[model samples]
Target: MAAMYQVITPQKPAAILKGVGPKVAEKLSSIGIETVNDVLFHLPANYENLSVMNLADAENNDKVTVMGTVMTEPAVAYFRGGKNRLTVFMEIDGIYVKVTFFNQPYLKDKLIVGEEARLSGKYLKHKLEINGQRLIYEAGGGFRVTYPMGKVMHSKTFNKIVAEVFGGFSFNYDLPETVKAKYRLLSVREALRLIHFPKSPADIKEGRRTIKFYELFMFQLRLMEKRQKERVRNERYIIDYDIDELKAFIDTLPFGLTGDQKKCTNEICRDLKQNVSMHRLLQGDVGSGKTIVAGIAAYAVKTIGEQTAVMVPTEVLANQHYQSFTDTFEDRLTIAKLTGTTTRKEKMEIVSRLESGEIDLIVGTHALIEDDVLFNRLSLIITDEQHRFGVNQRKRLNDKAHRKNVLYMTATPIPRTLSITTFGDMDVSIIREMPKGRKPVETYWRRYDEVDEVMASIASEVRKGHSAYIVAPLIEESETLDLKNVQEIYHMFLDCFGEEQVELVHGRMKPAEKNEGMGRFERLEKPVLVSTTVIEVGINVPNATYMVIFNAERFGLSTLHQLRGRVGRSDMQSYCALISDPKTENAKQRIDIMTSTTDGFELSEQDLEMRGPGDYFGVRQSGLPEFKVADLAEDYRILEHARLSAIELSGEMREDA
Candidate 1:
């Protein structure tokens, strides 16, 4: 893989460049750009037409690049927390221009009283203000590239560095002609050049499409090859499930199954009955009853005198599943749990029982994958929130002697096209309809300043005997991030509601502590749980009908969706207020989609379109190679082509070998 990089020998540090010094290098390093290649590959966030705008025609919040002359001396404006804002009055076409820079005291020297300069930022119609202002030197008259800049760096600076590196030079290509021809891919040099600094909109489109295809194709190729190899392995779990028995079990369910749920259950059952080990993905929306489908599948396997191992992401979820499974199979089948927090004696007893066939069903977290955990007749494995664990991790939890059937469940709904393209090796079952008594969660987007308004809504709900959840991005405050941390918010809430009513939980907390906090919220002892994304998956509290996510813009779409799912578990109406004033247009778009729909699949699709592979876990968590550029949502059409091409090439490679 080292050969994949074509950078010259003795890789030059970014500091070696003409204008970069130690201080500038440190700023670049903060954003993971230390090498020349890093600078070359740091792609633009988006392209904006920065043509000079007529002030009379300019609208509020319009991104613009205007040439203006300084009209007044720069002044330092003081804000809270010792933040110093520099303001300079300018005249563009004799119209007033108020440009402000936050914490950039040195910027006062850049703009003189009468010098003409080009400025780039968002323009406002009312105050004639420009926010996020960056002094620009390059005219680029047509379109300017805006980067995801850091302190001490701006899009103009990146443009300068990239232009220098890309000038009068080109990189070499390594893709095979057959593959390149199949995907209609451009040369590596051309793609990089155009991607970083395109000559036209068409170049951007073509370059992006070409790079996206390669990323997606590479991911698909490796997965397809491994899947082909797995297909030839002998199936060790061949015991057939009785159709009549499975039907009898389904009929015994407390409530009638939704048609979609029933159909998905049947599909999974059919896969298990097959001799070829089943590799299936089960997808459903929140409160769509995926757990019941898994329960039904696990029960049928247990009835056949085989063990079923269910792996979850966290201890909270593991315990939650343990209770639910036990309640469902109390007198029907023997069940047990093993987690990281399990006592030595208890773990040993469970291990002994599992190996001796005393336990028919076992639920656990990563503890299930430990070498000491040996199943007696492990025929089936069901993983909840499947993407949390890598492929080999899931495979390790099942019996290695036999190729056991595997069922992966995710409450994060993805488009069917994407599912087929990404998980092409496995069959899929989707459940969109909710079971009886389940209600849809309502969501909204609000600004951070509207905390009082959000709290008022929560108070209204609490007065009606309902509960709420307040989630933060961080557990403790970091000097670097201005985010609302759990500790700070916890204290604020405690001061308002008192200790008896509010408890805290986060990823950093001990398993016992988390369980204690969740227990209080579940039993109504503490009506509110101030937490982090630790409650994102599988923690059920039907009475908690309201969730307020502070700094909601920090989370990914799927994660945000999962957090919202914690509420609206019952028929009672639930509310989710996403407290955020998204600074970027993309951030605002993400929050808007969350407010628009409760459908997980729709939100996932929108997320894909709005973000790249790095924004998501990508193929790395799913046991496939990671993509450097492709977006599953934005490159859906490209993914289709890549999957088909990869399949064809995989067959050809295997036959040739």
Candidate 2:
């Protein structure tokens, strides 16, 4: 038998779904064309139906598919001494047309005699004489061959179809009836077909609507599924406590608790006292005293011979809690702090104290959840600014307490409708009122020239034994930004208020230096504190009544809101000054949100509207649902639909479960 060379068939670019080369895959990914399914899902950003008309009827700029042939081969025209230019001249039946392929030296070989190929582009007309040769050029449209019209194609991705079966594909495939009616959508196959090759303009419009709704519906469905899972794993804490003791603790507080705070704390404590477990969120305005309320619930759990753990997002907040609790329930509660700043020996000691139930209240940052730090009968856990904590991280923290009652605090006020829908797992408590003697912070928006006036105001307050906070947008200035760096700003203020009166603090500073700067401000040694956003959270200076934010527009409203909260802690009237450089009307609008209202919930709503839901709550956080196309603020109807859908789906799933 003759040795037969086995013939191998090379895979076509379109046929080979897998094993796409890296460079081609990257290019495809850029256009969102990944897997075969992704290719199918790659709906056209837009569609255009080619106007097939005579060259005479075609407008000068209209893109038309004119059936034409090569009237002549591509020719090269030289100018002056040695200017080489290649040009292709062609014409259709009874229409004078020209095609120019520029600077392509190989164009002469690429175009054969009487060869036919399609070209699509804009039309141009210019009369030029090259090498004494007069050429009348009339450019009308891009060149293209005649084929079955109605293929959806993006302008950038034109000529990308390498598939042979594209023309043979038929749409109108049936989809699940439930999906069709629920989303008011069409089948994917139909949408793809109509988008690429629409029979009419109306078909393309309807196809687009169907695709948009389908995309939105799928996102809502995934969110609903997540809500259901959280519900299934729900746990309410067992609060073993005497009701009278909790009441006594509340009544004994120096100032009366706000009705909202009391009500929320009761709800949380009730959940803790339950047989199952409690996972609750306590969201309030800045300076609303969420920490103190959390401390009360934590102490309630400690009454039953169990320890309580409070985790803050930053070390400053942790230290604040450590100092506050250590003073509030002094001797009654043994409080320990565990942070990155804690030495190995101190950590081990704290860990030992925690395991032995000697530490009644442990306040710290992420160090509280490290592997070696175990708790003995940890019955309650509270997380400050809970949105910053990861889902898995919160789970681990709660698990470390072995499913103890969880209370999460957030200075960011979420809307009630949003809270009930996305945060359904947790019972919410809102602190709408400030403690008595804590004056409402007065806010002001000033242009750069008024900076001296604001600083003078801050200095006047500081001279009266009051403290002030000077905040900057960044620790250091970027090449693009001409704003003063935090250190430089500190020196400027020091020159204004003397070196002994002002102190500087930034994230890049050593922990001890930060603590020192903060301590000096706290102790009134340095009444004016110049810093970055690191001081935005959990810095309680009852004496600090003035907050001067430089380049205010560089910060977001929510963040600026938090910074403003650092003041107005004392009975004396406090103030916040937003000093914007090169201020414009847009800058005024942003800063005006703070100056207009002291209501955090209102500010939160406005921030949500301005920044969109995903960005306002941060992209990788648990507090808000991720929405792609639907605007939570503008698309309240869609939000309602998804919310109702989630409620109904969860209700049904729970009943069945």
Candidate that scores best on TM-score: 2
Give the Å shift of residue 451 in candidate 1: 3.2
For candidate 1, the lDDT comes to 0.79
**Error of model 2, residue 75, in angstroms:** 16
> Quick one: best lDDT, which candidate?
1
Q: What is the lDDT of candidate 2?
A: 0.69
Clashing pairs in 1: none
TM-score, predicted candidate 1 vs. hidden true structure: 0.68
TM-score, each model? 0.68, 0.74
